[model samples]
Target: MVLIGYWLIEKLFTFEAYKTRNNRGFIIRQITHHKTKQEKERQREKLINMEKRVLYGLVVMLMYLVGGGYSQGVVEWIRDKAEWEEILVKTEIHIGVMVTSPLCGAPCDIVNDQVARFVETYGDRIKFYKINVLETLFFALDYKILTVPTVIIFKEGTINLRFESLSDWGMFYELLVNSSILDFPPDLSPAPAPAPSDSDPDADLPPPLQSGE
Candidate 1:
């Protein structure tokens, strides 16, 4: 039975790898056909790098599976290292919404909606990320997340604010405003005209003559 399972796993991975190779070849052909000499060389280099990354990923997965999950420690270590690297190296202010699956009901739904709106509103200024706790337990544990629909804001590689079970958009907005992470939505109203100053020679000039005067 174990041997059969291993064979099945190998076949599955082989099929996936074959598909990936076909796709990669097609993309490379297209790149070569369209690009000039310099661009073609650069693009081919990039494709080769991408292929290496994909192959490395597959090898890592096969090793894990073939070894009967013996690579679990190595995988965890890599994940932790990558997480810390991201936290420390990223320059943008990060807003992470941690939620359970969509099937978790009303709270998750609310969080999803609010997170979408928040991203749409402030996406240019902040980096927004969503973590599904059910799918990514490593992130949940790393962030010490204990509740569903938790929101965490990170500034300068440190946790700035964390709120659990947030359901109200208004309250969340207020928190962001109060914490000075985000300024209140700019008043779309036009700025008042500056008071005329003695130094403004242009203002003293009479309005330009209208055409056909």
Candidate 2:
């Protein structure tokens, strides 16, 4: 009876040892799996952070490029401001003197047309002021303009050139050209004659009847 009891106890203790070993193996596997999952999560977080940093850097670089281009454009535009201002001021004042009475007819019209042409041609370089003789007799007398259409080129608030009747474009152009106000030469060529065509009636005119024997 004692031997039988001792054998049964030994068998039970061996079975209990096998169960304990298996439980220990399962606990070790669970710990290893948990560690692997934690490591993967940490790597994913690092990659996301890296991507964010790269995106931020790109945004900063783009902003700098835009800002720098804008600054350069603004600087260039400001650089031309002074030259434009000087041109505006000079163009507001022009080269003309007051004309007084004893002036009328074709001469008056010619002078007015000349002044208008001067304004058209040199509008960018000079100003035009017209003082009619009948209207501004006092001013014409003050300038001692005995002639009907007298011109005075004013520079720096002083008289530069005084000339009588600009009867032709050449005469006026010469006045400014000699004084350095007109830098370029004017066109002086005569117009060309029209070409003959078969469709023209004059071209188809019959020759005079023969009279010679």
Candidate 3:
């Protein structure tokens, strides 16, 4: 939801670019004290509409994902709090999961589509999970999550990093990279024996003791 929101916002800014990329002409007009109040209002109106589309688009995309089309096996979905807790304590390396919603807009949709590749690449380093805010509302309330695509990186059940809104695939990449903080357990094999000494073993024996006696 967060990722798509940002993408939509980016798209909206470009949706109404004035004549050119910079819109420097508008700036020049403003500097010269030219009469351009109507243009200002137009831009404002565009901004307003952009916001509306962002919200609406998010809802539409979320609905589509809730159905069977959402990519499965990309990341394990947490069905209940028991499952969430089990993963937290049992996993040795660290934990990373996303808190999202069924109603989340384009940002969540974008993350849903793009995150599978990173998961496949880094799935060995650490396991990734997704918690539905609607199904598991307790986790969301516990984490104080009000937005979709919030990511929590934790180790041994302790949170290390938290992203309030995941607005792009980069966040997923970062999560995978950081999950390796506690990589595979150290090797536990015994040490090798030392090399044999070169000196004679009986050199210091009682060869001279008999004569002295």
lDDT of each: 0.61, 0.56, 0.68
- TM-scores vs. true structure, each candidate: 0.43, 0.37, 0.52
- Residue-wise C-alpha lDDT for candidate 2, range 1-213, written one tens digit per residue: 899999999999999999999999999999999999999999999999677556545544554465331121111111233543453356445445435245444444444444555555566555645556565545556577777666666655567667775534224544554565565455679989876685876775688898888
Candidate 1 lDDT over 1-213, as tens digits, reads: 999999999999999999999999999998887777778789999999677556545544554466442211111122344665665576565545444565555455444444554555666556655666766777777788777667777777778778885544325545654665665455789999877788876976789888894
> Each model's number of backbone clashes?
0, 3, 7
| Candidate 3 residue 121 C-alpha distance from true site, Å | 0.8
On the 0 to 100 scale, the lDDT of residue 96 in model 3 is 72
lDDT of 2: 0.56
RMSD of 1: 25.0
Between 1 and 3, whose TM-score is larger?
Answer: 3
Error of 3 at 155 (Å): 1.1
Model 1, TM vs. native: 0.43
Tens-place lDDT digits, model 3, residues 127-208 = 6788888889879877888777887778777887777643444355555555554466456799898655559766555575
Q: By the TM-score metric, which is better: model 2 or model 3?
A: 3
